[model samples]
Target: MDILDKLKNREEIYYPIERNRNTDLRFTLYDAFLAKKRFERFAPLFMEAFEEINGPCYYKSDLYKSKLGADVYLKLDSELKVAHSVKARGGFNEVMVKVEDVLKENGMLDKFDELSLNDIRKIMAAYTIEVSSTGNLGLSIGLCAKAFGFKAKVHMSRDAKDWKKKLLREVGAEVIEYDSDYTYAVKMGRLSAEQNHMSYFVDDEMSEKLFLGYAASIFEVAEQVASSGLIPSDDEPLHVFLPCGVGGAPGGIAFALRSFFKDSVRIYFVEPTEYPCMLYSFVHGEAASVNDIGLGGKTIADGLACSAPSKLVFPIVDSLIDGFFSFNDESILRAKKDIEEIDEKVVEASSAAALLAYEKINRPKNSILWITGSNVDK
Candidate 1:
């Protein structure tokens, strides 16, 4: 059976809480301006970093109206490309829309011509895939694969939430569930790509595309600071704290900060004490496995649960990261609660982890904290 048929055969997964279907999440014009300002402020930093690695690329920033208000969106400029949602916890459809926008913008409508037909049956095909946590990425990857005459697969852990798995199936990804966790899912995905002779691994953990996509966050922050008159003087370094999981986000941020600020800013990394692969690596002065440190622990922050550091990110971490901070689940939870109390907005446990560590470290005033994602399922 074809992917669409297979998706039709799969059952829909339900969640205990009522899912928010309203796409008109409200954001004030001022808020939109703030987000755009942030993007503009950081655009140069992102451009410079991306140029160093992958040449020139265009950027798109817009507010996505969702049940949770406006979400910031970003993408890489490529002939056949994928767009990623900033929300770490958004589901499949959100990701699909972003990819569709990219395809539409690039005028690559012909790429999907063959897949639009029902008669053609091909055993294997090459696909430009995009991946992220939850099933949202699966939807985009599957849709782009279908539109562009390619096959797509999404890797998810057995621990992945049930709704996410269903969403993956709905989006036409052959959802491959690993026996272990998300880290293992990534390893399995690499192997599966090799065995299937696929065009590329839509790797979030190690791919330059994925890392550079996130580095845009740093650019946005830099712009926000400068425009808001928050930029420190030349002699005063901007200390940046970021939460590390597989090291993609932190690695990207560090690369941008180091390139722009050089010795002007200090970069600090934060990881959950339960799965502190990055911290262990930093402390040992070399890359080390999570198993070697025996640091595994259960936490609500599943996104940060990485068993190993990415080989691609190690060099950047060694050179750019100044220090590391470790925090327990309790601290992350407290941070989440504190953010909610202060802003009345629920920040995910992982998102709050960086700010939590920053508070604990008591760094110099004006230090910047990278609030990575808003994927808190609760």
Candidate 2:
């Protein structure tokens, strides 16, 4: 889907941390008793499945830093996984949770150590998974689903790149195209799940599984930050700027960072001005689409062309985000163009959004700008 769309499910998931349990991530597969187990089972695999051995965040001295007037570091998630995007973390996690569910439901899996790959594959083959996406999410979802032996389908909108759909199809996933935008594609995907048995929809806007999966990246970032010698304290605060789409990735990571770094961190979300869905929803006190706010046009930054901020991710973003900032397509294009011209690197407009966050706000000194995707068409 072109333009689109938290886990506001349970009460205590957002509560104070007196319980010594992780309030940062609560999902179907996680609880106070099972948190460590969940992390142990998933974190290593999150690294392994996504080729995260060199999961990197680098400090850069560039013209963008001068423009932002901050000590800027880049979290290069654009280069992550086979999918080569930030969605790799969340998409893989969602499918693995389904793997757990299928294994448990059939009374098959006991421990990860005891599981047989052959047996797991046999079980996974019976399940089918579906998700609606603009592009990047489909790559991660399709790749994960294919790897796990599940029949996968991606329902998408016109704003999605043709190459993304082609890549998904090449991997044996059914690509369902729609002339409509992201929200419409998502509704159709939801309808199919309602009608089909043994089918699961990986809802980008609202899946707790996806939210927590992306949240797990904080551990990787913490490790990277430590190695980079970047400290998060009042004297040298860690400022994170993430590109906001449906808000799952940015919100998940932001809240998790807040739990880890607390007051020493400030998280900001950057959105395309034409489709500042999160900004509108955050300020308006409801689910407000781009059409609701009278913004139109397909964008070069198709990833950020979301109509509404995700309901599932909104509360976390509202609570944890230091600010929500918006910029025009021209700004994003210029950022992408300038970076390519200066650094001789080709990055998607979405990747440039994090750096553009600095231009909009009065940012802090030590900053981390996450480059979320590299899937740009030349």
Candidate 3:
């Protein structure tokens, strides 16, 4: 069968349907309505995001779903070039998957797995690096290190969720807690990593792989939009608003959109007023640390409560994004209520923050808001 047929026939093992030998699982009309509503709400956003970025061809993979995240897929081009996955926390898993694919292609899968642990240790030792963060990127790297049989150390801010800290420990990572915020934890992690022998800091903050992998979301969005026939006319530009954490998602989406849309799409970035790293960066003409911002230390939007932007993503944001907006906690709460009322879907505060910004700024009718993830701890 052709690739298209294969994709169409790809059944989700987790949601199995019975055949003649058994029986097909039937869905009520209500179920169908809910499903359609979800698709209508999300598909258009994905499609427009992809088309404006000029992604021509792609395929979807089930990796993200397997991890209990969203049902995400990796996109590929006609030449079978793998572009990016739609996973929110695209960090170590993204890197490992690509590396493993390359190794498998070279007939070195077993050797690659065997060498990965030692290789990681050597690299860490060389760089004197210790990875630290309160976010998924750091957690993913720590998990990867443990999987590869390498020791991992992480520093998390006091405000970090308890579950995250527990998960880090469950993966055999050495976890340190800081009394201060994320930036302070990062500094402590860096200093400790530098002082210890055989320690290498896997600074997710500066890692090109992390930011590049995160950018892949746009490629999928581009392809989906093109396939859905929702590409905006050449005369009018699509406006895209992305929520900001450490500016990774905004930076990645902006970079891809810039490459695809050129001057045809206007990009806006939104961040919590409590941590407006991207907005601060844009206003300052360079990437600025949020450590000094009084409100930068905390937010109900845990995913977007980052106090600094990644150095790698800053340039992309500076050049590609047209505007930046900051939303307060009260506004985010109202936005969340509005989304739940409109779609009956539960979205995290981070995602709602983007919508709130759009409402506050009086965004264009043809605008797109990236509701990035639903990883709320509530």
Q: Top TM-score: which candidate number?
A: 2
Root-mean-square deviation (CA) per prediction: 15.2, 7.6, 17.4
Error of 1 at 198 (Å): 3.8
lDDT of candidate 2 over 1-378, digit per residue (tens): 112221111010111112112244443322211422454565544444445343322111122232334476777677564777778777877887889899889886676556555556678999899999989988888988887789998999878989899888988999999998898999999998778898999999888777776777776677777777677896677988888888998877776787788778878888777677776676566777866646645777888878887888775565577676676777789888765676555678987877677655555577888878764453
- Candidate 2: segments with Cα more than 4 A from true spot: 1-70, 111-116, 375-378
- The global C-alpha lDDT for each of the candidates, from Candidate 1 onward, is 0.51, 0.71, 0.54
**Residue-level lDDT for 171 in candidate 3:** 58
Candidate 3 ranges beyond 4 A from true positions: 1-89, 93-129, 291-293, 361-363, 376-378
TM-scores for all candidates?
0.64, 0.83, 0.66
Question: Model 1: per-residue lDDT, tens digit, 12-67?
Answer: 11111121223231222333334334334433433442332232222332211112
Inter-residue clash pairs, candidate 2: 1-133, 1-157, 4-306, 4-307, 5-246, 6-312, 6-313
**Candidate 1 wrongly placed segments (more than 4 Å):** 1-150, 375-378
| Residues 245-268, model 3: lDDT tens digits | 776546655666666666677677
